[model samples]
Target: MPSSKPAFFFSSTQSVDNRLGDVFSFIWGSYAGLRELWWQVRGFNTQFPDLHISEIENKFLAGLPMPGGIDFKKLFVKTDWAEHEKDFSRWILFDVCTLYEGWAEKVCKDLFSSSTYERNAKAIQFPSGVRANRQVSGYPVAVNEANTSASTLMKDEFLPTLKKSYLNCWSFIDQHLLAYRFFKECRNSFIHSEGVVTQDIIDKHTELATIQAVKPSPFRNNFILPSQTLGQSIELNLKDCINFATIVRKLICTFDAALSVAMASEAILEQRIRNLVSNNPKWNNLPSDPAKREQRVHRMLAASRIPEPQNFANMMAWMQSKGII
Candidate 1:
């Protein structure tokens, strides 16, 4: 099986995390199921040597539900199982790439929407110390070379939006950001180049990484595709997918732990809530009394979504802790 032990990946950001989990589960579930079928068919044949393999396969597939838009018969014939398993692994990594980028983009948009922050994030000046790739401090990002990644999203969109002092809190669990992007480069090749290893992906390999922290991933070497394999179709096997998925999950967990703590603090969350309440004129017609107005605001906030901070325990906890409605 291509699966490791089940992982429970979540940020305090339930909305985004849940979506990520759902996508991860669906792709992984299908990958394991394909391999599981491969083994089960052989095991069943061992028990009943006289029976035809075709009969056993038909019986097994008949028991499984056939969803719309899928041609299971043509897709999963006797000879197709090996290729099918390989295909699932390829897609699993591809899907993982999409999930990581989507979640990062969503969080980036949410965190930067506060009215108190500069409207033009590019205008904000981040300190040199923050950008410098120091020992275990921060990894250098290659936004120009790569298509999309956690490092790219943070460097290009999210980090610029935050105040300069808060940069210390923004640490990555993954030290080798370029090594991580190599997997994403494979993902892009699959997407735009139709699974063929392109010149672009080969060029980015091994050399594209700018920051190699003192403690980089042991799998850092895995990011480099052999130069000989260029121009050929990507040979994404089960092990490759296992590595890709593990790294993506680790990054998400690390990001969630750090950002959730920052979000819980008064300096960030309070300003976010203030921005939300102050900017929009939607609550102009509240009750005249102070107590009634406070009650109404909490009620309204509960019903509507909290856009900033990206994740939270609840609105009430934040309201009581921060002394804001």
Candidate 2:
């Protein structure tokens, strides 16, 4: 007896030009919608008892007469339905964490794809005319593909090579990873075991409980109810989900800025090289043969020590001093 109507209703039209921005907007919209829905449900229940239609409907539905001096009122009001609230919070938190992980994977792919860094790999040659061949891949493919946890991805793939300026950003993400893992476990338990709290789950929660303070400063604030026993379960509230969404937005912004900087720097370096080849009389006067032209450019670039353009500004300055630009 399945109903044709959907259990939930949501609609959005994302901008095609900015996928990452669209993701952030979607996350923000979802959080706001959840909050609005929660308040609406709370207010509806609060007003239900005052409405005469509710009592009439109840009597008609139950097929019972309204007895003398009987108070026909709902037992629960003010959003105090504990089980429903708990389930709602858990669902929201789980969705936010899952989306955050997907966003991180996209960032990894955008930053470390083969097309982005394959040419940057250093080539090594041996005396016997042998060269080493190493395959380049995106961060997700190059790192542990089996591990899908965002926390693990940060630790294994990003933290090791992140710049000092970006350490604060990494810390912001790290602070939430434990809570995200715990939420993931809770989601699994609910899905597989009807929300039964097992000993193993409790132990795992206990192990992850004390990595950091429950409150993530002013930036992100998520709660993990301390569970010390087998029967107890972790709890995430609406505020926790909202805070997590905020942190995720911050991570996306910071990572996008860093990637943009790297890309601009790369573009600047390439432009400098092109300018050098085009403007320098020596390189410009070289034979029009493609191979010879390439060889001359290579020799000129090598002599100017510009093989790997690490610092774009410094490289440009050096090239100008060497009359290569």
Most accurate candidate by TM-score: 1
TM-score of each: 0.51, 0.41
Tens digit of per-residue lDDT, candidate 1, span 1-325? 1122112112233454466568768877876786677667666767877876567666677666766544433554344565775677777776777676665554434443454123212111111124244521222121111112223222332333331322122353333344456667778777788888877666546443333323553343343243426789876666657666666655554344333222222244455456766776665566878677656665444333322222223444556566554
Q: List the residue pairs that clash in candidate 1.
A: none
- List lDDT for all candidates, in order: 0.48, 0.44
Q: Which regions of candidate 2 are displaced past 4 Å?
A: 1-84, 109-167, 171-175, 213-234, 247-325
For model 2, residues 58-104, the per-residue Cα lDDT tens digits are: 53336656455332233223334565456556756666556555554
C-alpha lDDT of candidate 1 relative to the true structure: 0.48
Worst 10-residue lDDT window, candidate 1: 120-129
> Which candidate should be chosen as best, given lDDT against the real structure?
1
Q: Which ten residues in a row have the lowest lDDT in candidate 2?
A: 7-16
